[model samples]
Target: MAVEQNSLIENYSIVIVNVAVAVIHYQDQYLLGFRAASQHQGNRYEFVGGKIDAHETATQALIREVSEETGIDIANNIAVKLGRLHHDYGDKRVCLQVYRIEVTAQQYQQYKNLSQGLEGQKLTWVEKQKLLAGDYDLPAANKTILAWLQLPTQISITYPLEHFNNASNPMTVWVQYHQEHLQIGALVYIRIKETGTEESINQLLHLRNDIKAIIPYNFYTEKADNTVINRQIVARHLTQAQLMQCSNGIAKNDIPDFIIASSLPLVVSCHDKESIDAANQLAKACLKHQLAPVIGIFLAPVEYTQTHPDTSPLGWEAWSRLAELADIPVIGLGGLSPVMSDQAMLHGGVAVAGIRQFFK
Candidate 1:
């Protein structure tokens, strides 16, 4: 027993060993495995790993698991321990030891076939921004893993447009990224919300030439309308499939970028909690796509404080949390005046988004 223990701990000065894990990166995305539906925490994305086998070293376990799941074998010389995480799940406690592994293109290609359903699992490569956007449900343990793997890398393209007096005038823009010019196959989307006017919709459609596709919100019934509401009108009017195909066009390109989903707010009877939650969710989703920064027009209610004094303040907190979680800029919309712009950012926003303030 003493000799066996000495063998496991031979090279290590530290006596205690922790369960080890590995984070695999490909094209600025981390490889994650989806836990299939089971009695345990299934349907959540998790790092590919398992408990270290008895008498086996963490490095040995990592190499084995990587080979099992990804088919790409890591040279023992290349595997390096990045960090470790200690966390407690509801049912079980785990100490996840993490490593950083680098692989060559040839090795990746060779292992691609063997990388399927290792330990009977599904896998995916998710970009850091998408991971932060929180679209897919992740296990609690994986969240900690993600926070540690957050590398400082520029993975987004930003296009800043100069405002023109004539909406029809081609908007001069600067696309900022390491790449000089966008590839031919890159797809962009131009989206607009209905402001109860056909002219606005037409103006947005005209901008479609600059983008690969356009999506317009067309199905909205006024509260005063006693007639049956047609939800399908929005679906029918929008070219969703075309938009999706355009969005997917990036796969063929060496590097892909997108711009989609603009926002325009119309006056409604109430700014309820549900509406605020939905808006928060949408904002997070948009940031995940790294779409053009949204410009929202907040139509203030006639009697703002009377109906939603309590709820109005909560929106700031919700927006703050979303910004923190998603690490994306948000421009506050409702009741924002020039005087309040600075305060809004301090609370949690990029700038004020309102027709009166922004248009001027």
Candidate 2:
């Protein structure tokens, strides 16, 4: 009877395995294919690849799958592992390992013409903007992979500066820091802490010179709803009160028109599950207003000095689960530092973000 019970459990349980997916990028666009209309997720668009064979590496599986699906041989070394996603489809559970496959412009064009759907699926090249704006419907599980692709690998946030205007050589500090970490693809965010007032507004402009000195890629000011500056990504950090305001704005279709017209991408911060849900809701609202939404979360507290000692950290497993739920690029915050950047990516973070990590 015990043997029969064990057999029943084995037979009823779902099979677990890995699926390799290719994210082929060319000319600021990505390659995606439509699933066959008869399959389980038929008539939907997805990154193309197949199952990983027994004892096969992710790269080996990617090369084989790309060739079989698109008739293009992706060089093994050129395929960079982005991240992995754990998904369950009731009867089957899978770890979808995604890779970024690189190809030359001429090679991409030639393959675009020559590539045939080996599995009777339709293939198309899509711009990143279209993908973010919901131009195509993707399978629920694959959304996390798309979001991961949108995030920068490194992020640096500023520490609160109450005496920046009186300090000497502030710009030098910024210049030296940028020179040291220039190659890391870092985005700088100037944290905004203020109430509406003339003195506070004037004080805010003190860092403008230092900000301008940094290279003009991915630099932005946070909590920027009141002012629109040049060459900076305007942002808003939502608290409980502001979140209710956002909800009302979305419901009344009253999110300001400037959001849709602004070229700067929007970043939203989430501290807990309630804020995470609010961020998700705010993202959809941002999309409706033609704004790009990126979610930031405080997943862990590394040191007692950083926050409450009794507060439990989310750790890697919980962080990954919460990030998957975001369905948009997520920046890992809280206790993260430069050393844990790679580990952050492993657990589904688009980038490692912190105040002390990049600033003193």
Candidate 3:
């Protein structure tokens, strides 16, 4: 699945397709079907879904697809929009609207013994870790799906100050708060926006062993490569420009393997469709190069941010549009509260993220 291949689509005006793919999750396992060798992109493990009918919504198509393929009805289940992917298979241009629905133990067990889909396609349950590790052979576009799967729905990003705005030792307070949050299983992005990110990450790295962090790339300069940053809390953030650089490197086969190979995952701060495209391209490059793909992206300014006062927020409507373009998980950031996670998910975001609201 990680082998690199050359398949270029020259024509840009081909008819586009809408496909509804489901990632049915149960106890850290995802249900997948093994395509027959006669099918396109055959012999690979794939999620069960099909082209959406002209008369149906994405949800309607997904419910129908899952039923026809797996004999499992998802009409009553809550299908959360995971991400959207637009890919060209040369023969077909497809826009995949991916959704994830969790099944209970009873439901999983009921279908677990089936061994094959209703269409006679082989079915297997890939473990969460194996899927995340890029173990199973999947279709090329599924590289983005693997990256998105690594992410937790809830994320917490640190601010210079959350509730303690007046503290002389605000970074200290942030350190304590972030450590506590991480210990409790909150996936926190270690960013100290006010006093600078470097020193803050250095401090956090030394304080604890259990800290799960996503460091950011320094927004101040292009000189700082993947090697420079503490690889901290931004778990180093990539701008669209930076992701473009990686994409270019993948083309030339000259990019360093550290970022592509590291335990640290790339998370981009995307404000528009173009940025999401850049990130998606980088994910494809990683899969091509047999390296670790981008983990996810942060789509920000869901509301006005007091920290970044000048940058306007992308409200729910605009944010949803951008999220629909992202093939990776999109965390709704800026001026958001934990309570808004559901709202974010409803509007195509994987989760809501923030400093002021979430930290408090």
Candidate 4:
């Protein structure tokens, strides 16, 4: 079994262990068990499995847990190892060894009789079609099982905000897969408006020299002077769709670790309350879907409006609450001098994002 340690604040360490999970499907319906309320993730739907006890091999543990939980005596020869799953539950982690098992009619009947009136565990057979409909709130480990069971599809990539908007450094994005580093793919979407100027776009191209293909921003403007601005805005909107489509297209494609919307404040005025509200809603929805985390960048103006109330920079409290509810990481942007990174972290952000401050 592989061991992984995840470090959290205050010296807390999360430990993950590897074990095996068995899937017994009959007529396209997979067997599942509801965990007892007393168990760590009580009441959640999970595959039939448990931690491998001392001196026991993975196969032995799988056999023992299946018998203990489902009362099914699976013949050793009938169990087939499928693959492995790595899961982290904040406090602990588990690498699941997956297996597919076959059960005969006679064995099912005998197991049914033995499992009757069992305490804490509720067993059921769920159709694969219904399972794919996303009806149940399953544990992370179970989700890995389902992914393995499903047909192979394109990889999905998601680019969150934190990766790109480093205040002190010119914008850059990191990509990852299964928490491992990966290079960007050929087709990349660059938001022209977010890049602001042709020079900036060229600079970005230089930074991502490895990329051979890029979908440039096409502006929409009736006037000559505003052509660039229009194109940028159009590019921004298109980039959003491109990012989403890329994320849903291939699971193997490395998800961008961050997206740099702009080094400057994208919203020129705080008075656009509707835009702020819409952004918040979108962020919330993404979080609900387990999409990438969002970081709001607040590039401060050179001068402050004396008439405005003395509010914390960028209404930090409001954004912090929204991110917290969605379990999304938020990094404060704008006027984030190097010294303020600590303060931003204290305010529930992973870190501060800034060009001047980041490089400094």
Clashing pairs in 1: 21-97
Q: Give the per-residue lDDT of model 3 (tens digit) for 1-360.
A: 011111223465567677889999887988989999999899899988998877778888889999999988888877777766666577876777788888877788898776888889999887899887878888877767776776776777775555566778876776776666553545677654454645556666556544456765552232344333333332456765666666666556666555654644578777777777777776656555566556677888889998789999889999988887776778888888888888888887788777656543
| Cα lDDT of model 2 by residue, 215-282, tens digit | 11122333455353343233434443455556666666777554455454456665466666665666
Best by lDDT: 3
**Model 1: per-residue Cα lDDT over 1-360, one tens digit each:** 000121233245423325667776654666777887883578787777766777666778787877777666774435434334434454554555565555566655554444345566777766767876776687665554443343211111112222222344423322122023432322222223324433332333233222222124443332233222221111111232322343334333311222243332211111234333333333333333443322221222212332235544435655554433222233344544445655554554434433233211
Give lDDT per model, in order: 0.41, 0.58, 0.72, 0.45
The regions of model 3 sitting more than 4 angstroms off are: 1-18, 54-57, 86-95, 104-106, 161-174, 181-183, 193-203, 218-235, 239-264, 273-292, 309-313, 357-360
> Which should have the higher lDDT, number 1 or number 4?
4
Off by over 4 Å in 4: 1-14, 112-120, 152-360
lDDT of 2 at 114: 41
Q: Who wins the TM-score comparison?
A: 3
* TM-scores for the candidates: 0.37, 0.52, 0.74, 0.40
**1 or 2, greater by TM-score:** 2
Off-target runs (Cα >4 Å) in candidate 2 are 1-22, 25-68, 71-150, 162-185, 195-229, 232-241, 248-263, 289-312
Q: Which pairs, if any, clash in model 2?
A: none
Name the regions of candidate 1 deviating beyond 4 angstroms.
Answer: 1-18, 111-115, 153-360
Q: State the weakest 10-residue window (summed lDDT) of model 1.
A: 228-237
Listing every candidate in turn, what is its Cα RMSD in Å to the true structure after a full C-alpha superposition? 17.5, 9.8, 6.3, 18.7
Clashes of 4: 23
